[model samples]
Target: MTDIVMEAKNVYKTYGGSSKKADLKLVEAVKDVSLQIRKGDIKLIFGPSGSGKSTFLRCLAMLDIPDKGEIYLGDECLTKPGVDLNKARARIGFVFQNIYLFRHLTALGNVELALRRVLKLPKEEARERALAALTEVRVTDCANKYPAQMSGGQAQRVGIARAIVRNPDIILLDEPTSALDPELTGEVIDTLRDLAKEGTTMLIVSHEMPFARDVAEEMIFYDEGKIVETGPPSVFFNAPSTDRAKKFMDRIIKRTTRE
Candidate 1:
């Protein structure tokens, strides 16, 4: 049997609230979404703006809690509201689109901080792991450089290194290349592809179709808080069965051609 690394069941999340007189609109960002990710599987989630892909990713990462549903990392329950979130978070790495390294910290410092603070490793051991993680992302040369001294791509590599240094079972990426220049995105994508080859299970929120097609085991088409389609790239890209999916693909094509 395939080992299920993580699973989300009937998850629902909403935002916005109301006072006594004011009617606050509730936005259902994630709607009864169920998903399963097997060990070493790379799943890509794609959608346009306001499609709730990022919110869904945050829910998976436990950066945000769902209003209702259960999230499981193997046999451990992650969405029980009062559950030990720190323990759950330790098992999942997260790379955000915006690189938020400490301004004063060098690349090695940024990565080692996570190991020391979250994993509680000794300074010497954390330093060793940090270097290994930086080398894995091919950013060892930038180890001594602060975020301000590095390029966008190089900084992102350090962010990735921070995530992987924890040795989590899954790594969640939120539009990891969206903030990067078209040219600068290649290095980060290369690192991600290498991670895939090394059997790092990942769930990525992205619109970078070419990278997803090449590395993703499956693609999920999420729009308006729901999954419109889910399948291998061959099926989702070449033979989308839903009208919503077809229109979304058309939009992607138009945007790509214009660029």
Candidate 2:
């Protein structure tokens, strides 16, 4: 058996209980979703916008509370309804589409904040860790720059730096390259691939299909809040089992093979 680092069982989430008109509908963001990510695996959860991909990632990161189901992080239960959610959250590092950083803090400060407050490390130690994280993303030169002063890619590097500085074994990325251009996207993707090589477990919800095929050890196609197909990249891309995957590939070709 693969060394499992994270697992989600029977997970479900609903949003929007009320509507402006009386014909309100509760959107099921995630529906009975279950999957396991092995240690050192780079797994991609591919889905369209509003397909619950982000919500699923947030639930995995413990940034959002799930309505039903159980989540396990290295044998620790995350969703017990009344369990201590903070402890569960501390174990997963999260990076998002938008780089959330303090406007006044430098890139180094952004990465060091969590180390200083959450990890309770001394200032020098935290700064050293932050520097290492920035170096990992090849953005150590931007350490003293503010978020507003840096490029989107540099800001994103800082975001990744902040997430990894905690040294969490599992990193959850939520559409991390959604706003980045191709060049910048490649930079972060390269950094992530290096992390995967170093044995860090990663769960990525992304739209970049080619990157998924190249970097992910395995991938799942999510639609209507369900995983319709899942397998290694070769099987997922070349021998998808379901019609949903076929249709998805068709769209991918239509978009990519366009003149």
Candidate 3:
């Protein structure tokens, strides 16, 4: 088996170029970007707000189809014409920034939905697995609670449970803690830290510098829809090679310290 769990090659995605709006210019959200995540790799991508880190992540999961380039999940090239994206996505877990849990379902129900529906597991087995996932994320106490009843931290942990219930090859998180209150962020970050301890392969777009420094195997500095630099956390913290990365780190670190 290949060491690479996921790979993106020359991926490009654009929007509004052909739109009829006279004032709208084309937006190249992901421009010729390529990345690879090997087994048990924890890579963090960080940059300015509108730099397209989330877009690139979506393209990696096939949630958004790229206009050009190839995305590979292990040996399967997901960009191929006849590939089954649903199956491909099943092996990949995605945690959104906003924590989109189903309002109607209890936390367990939300997590079990995929195992029961998509994976076609039996009822009892799905429930057991769902409970186990909730326990793993430290959200088992919220299993019977609906999204509306849970706190932001609890809801996000449930969201994580839902994603990991399927035992995906890797988890792609888009600023998982950004939507929560500052006080609530710690619980979520702790859960992620636990996952890191267990060697989960994750590609996270997060600005949590402490978490990144502690958990990430490599840090990628992305900007303007392109990767400006990539290196270990120590390299970025001490000295980034590129001027852009250095400047960005200075600004971000100052802001972080202020906060």
Give the best candidate by TM-score.
Answer: 3
Query: Where does candidate 2 stray beyond 4 Å?
Result: 18-23, 257-259
Query: How does candidate 3 score on lDDT?
Result: 0.94
Clashing pairs in 3: none
Evaluated with lDDT, which candidate comes out highest? 3
Which residue pairs clash within candidate 2?
none
lDDT of 2 by residue, 1-259 (tens): 5478899999998887876777567899999999998888889888667888888888777777789998888777887667777666767789987888899999999999988887789999999999999999899899999999998888887898888888786899988888988888888888887887788888988867777878888888998888878889888677789888878877875775572
Cand. 2 TM to true fold:
0.93
Global lDDT of each candidate: 0.91, 0.84, 0.94
Candidate scoring better on TM-score of 1 and 3: 3
What TM-score goes with each of the models? Answer: 0.96, 0.93, 0.98
lDDT by residue for model 1 (137-203), tens: 9999999999999999999999999999988999999999999998889999999999999999999
How well is each residue in 142-236 modelled by candidate 3, as lDDT tens digits?
A: 99999999999999999999989999999999999999988899999999999989889999999999888888999999998899899999999
Model 1 ranges with Cα > 4 A deviation:
none
User: What is the alpha-carbon RMSD of candidate 1 to the true structure?
Assistant: 1.4
Error of 2 at 92 (Å): 0.7
